[model samples]
Target: METRELRYFVAVAEELHFGRAAQRLGIAQPPLSRAIQQLERRLGVKLLERTNRTVTLTEAGSVLLREGRAALDAVDAAERRTRRAALAATGQPGLVLVTKAGASSELLSKLLDAYAAEPGAVTVDVHLCGIGEQERLLRDGRADVALLHRPFDSTVGFDTEDLRTEGQVAVLPAGHPLARRAGLRMDDVTALPDLPLPRWPGPDGTYPDGPGPQVRDHTQLLQLVGLGRAAAVLPDSCRAHLNADLAAVPVLDAPTVTTVIAWPPHSRSRALAGLVRAATLL
Candidate 1:
């Protein structure tokens, strides 16, 4: 019911282990367990199922986890917006724009130049983040806007405008058999027994179960591909950075990636509006 209770519930629900959740929350395990028990009692439902060796979420817990996460995000957004407002009242420099690192370099350069040329434009602070992080930065007011690639990044809670769309390419080691082809389909790349698709970390920083190596960003993924450890389906723009050791072949059947300018739905800053306008014009 309260923010503290929700925070505790989320931490425990995510970890599924009271001791680890307590450690993450910087509190003792018993207290964390008690808080969850109290929460369950107040809600009149079992949120977690616990035994000697394992802990798992109940159906109610699964529902609560999803709703509670959104509630917490709202709370965080409120606090962050208030702080940003206070800072702006004191004439803080400008808005922050976040984008995934090593993505859309050419488009970003053009967007920045266009926005800067506009009259009354404020100083823009660009924050380069890792994959799957742009949404959090926007939701929590750490960023005013983001350039997100659709199908890869979720745009569920934000307003967005399409900037560009391009097909995907499979980045493979130069000497790999598939790399010699002029173009290929998704099956050609995904079926490679030796070079599995790299698994990217979720927002929680845990890598999904897979045979391929886990990678955090484009640089790491490219390096892995060059070493023949992994293959990646990436935006076509990524070919600009590939070295001779790597080769990119068009993945004819892969879904096209659209780069969009996204922002929190409730944002009201004129500077943010101006930036969006400039970006759309590009």
Candidate 2:
């Protein structure tokens, strides 16, 4: 019921091992086990099933895990917003904008230029983050706005305006057979046994189970493609950065990626509003 209890429960639920969870939480194992027991008693439900070798969640634990995560995110957001407000009260003249590194470079340039040209624009601090990090940054008040690519990034809890949309391309080695084709469909690239698609890390930093090499960003993905080690589907704008060894072919059936300017729904800063307006008008 309390935030501390929820935190402990979430940690144990995630790790499924009291010792590991305790290590993660910087506390002793027995105390962490006791806290979970106390939490279960207070709720009058068996949250975890434990044995000599393994620990697993019960049905109630599964439900509580989901809801408790949301509750904790809300608490973190509240604390971050409060701190941000206190900082702003001291007359800081800037807003932090976050975006995926190496993405939407041209659009970002134009957006920054347009926003700077506004009559009362504040200093804009741009933060380049790894994939899937922008949403977290925005939710926790580390960033005031973000440029997110739809279908790649979730916009569930924010307000967004479409900036641009473009089709995807398959990035391959210049000498590959597919590189000579004028165009291709998704089927042309997906099942290439010789060129497995690279695996990207999920938000939790774990690579999905796959046969391909794991990559963290577009740069690494391109390098892999250039080495003929992997193939990747990327937004068309990425072609601007491709070297001669890399070739891009339009994937006729791939979904179009829409770049959007997103912000927290409850944001009330005048500078953030101005920046969003500037982006939309471009």
Candidate 3:
């Protein structure tokens, strides 16, 4: 029933001799014989036929010899693998940056491209999900780390790095009056006929000089602006128009969107720390 009893039974079974098995196991013969007897008593099976002149394995003893050796071998392998994994974790395992769907498209691609340009450095993988969902994954330990345009709450169990700052530009129809110049001052687009903005963070009136009309999403607002239906200011990284006639011009008064890479506080994993280090040049 117990591992030590199985070990003793295996040794005795292999040798088919009492004194030699005990000597090999570095145990006394009396205790070794008693251990084998206890094992058979527990299993309710006779394992060996023994006499003062000779010893021989029974049917059950042969089966146990094969299984016991396999069990001991498996235990040894498991212990070794666990020790190796612990060492690797202490040394800082390789990283994967789980980000919001839009965050990676903005900066993560450049960061990885730079990292990959150097052939021999440590590797990091990039993943993306919605901002709210990614935060949940980090909290529940389903994900090792996160990066997003939005701030992460402390209760979500994360440390964050505010890598860099950038501003958004207003997307307007190419033929619109504001789009004629290379860039427009905040005053130029602020007075547009009708402007659309995404519904988030705060009410549409949150802007000091609230634009008259607003749409529910940025990309859609941009498409409307390109079609001369409306105008809106959005993050520069947002490409509302690629082939159609729309132009993005800088908006001077808009606040910069801060991008962050966040992870659980003092995680057993070093995914966040490693990624932040590799991204220092950013």
- Give one digit per residue, the lDDT tens place, for model 2 in 1-282: 899999999999999998999999999999899999999999999999999989999999999999999899889988978887787778875889999888999999999999999998988999988778888888877788999999989999899999999999999999999999989998889889999998877877788998999887788788888888999999999999899999999999999999999998888888889999999999
192-264 in candidate 3: lDDT tens per residue?
Answer: 6555443332311243335444443444555566677766666677663333588778887777776676765
Give the local distance difference test score of model 2: 0.91
Off by over 4 Å in 3: 1-96, 102-106, 114-125, 130-133, 150-157, 182-193, 201-230, 239-244
How well does candidate 1 score on lDDT at residue 77? 84
Clashing pairs in 1: none
Backbone atom clashes (below 3 Å) for every candidate: 0, 0, 0
Note the residue pairs that clash in candidate 2: none
Model 2: worst 10 consecutive residues (lDDT sum) = 84-93
Candidate 3: 10-residue stretch with minimal lDDT: 198-207
Query: Residue 235 of model 1: what lDDT?
Result: 92
lDDT, residue 56, candidate 3 = 91
TM-score of each: 0.87, 0.92, 0.48
Where model 1 places Cα greater than 4 Å from the true spot, the runs are 11-42, 46-57
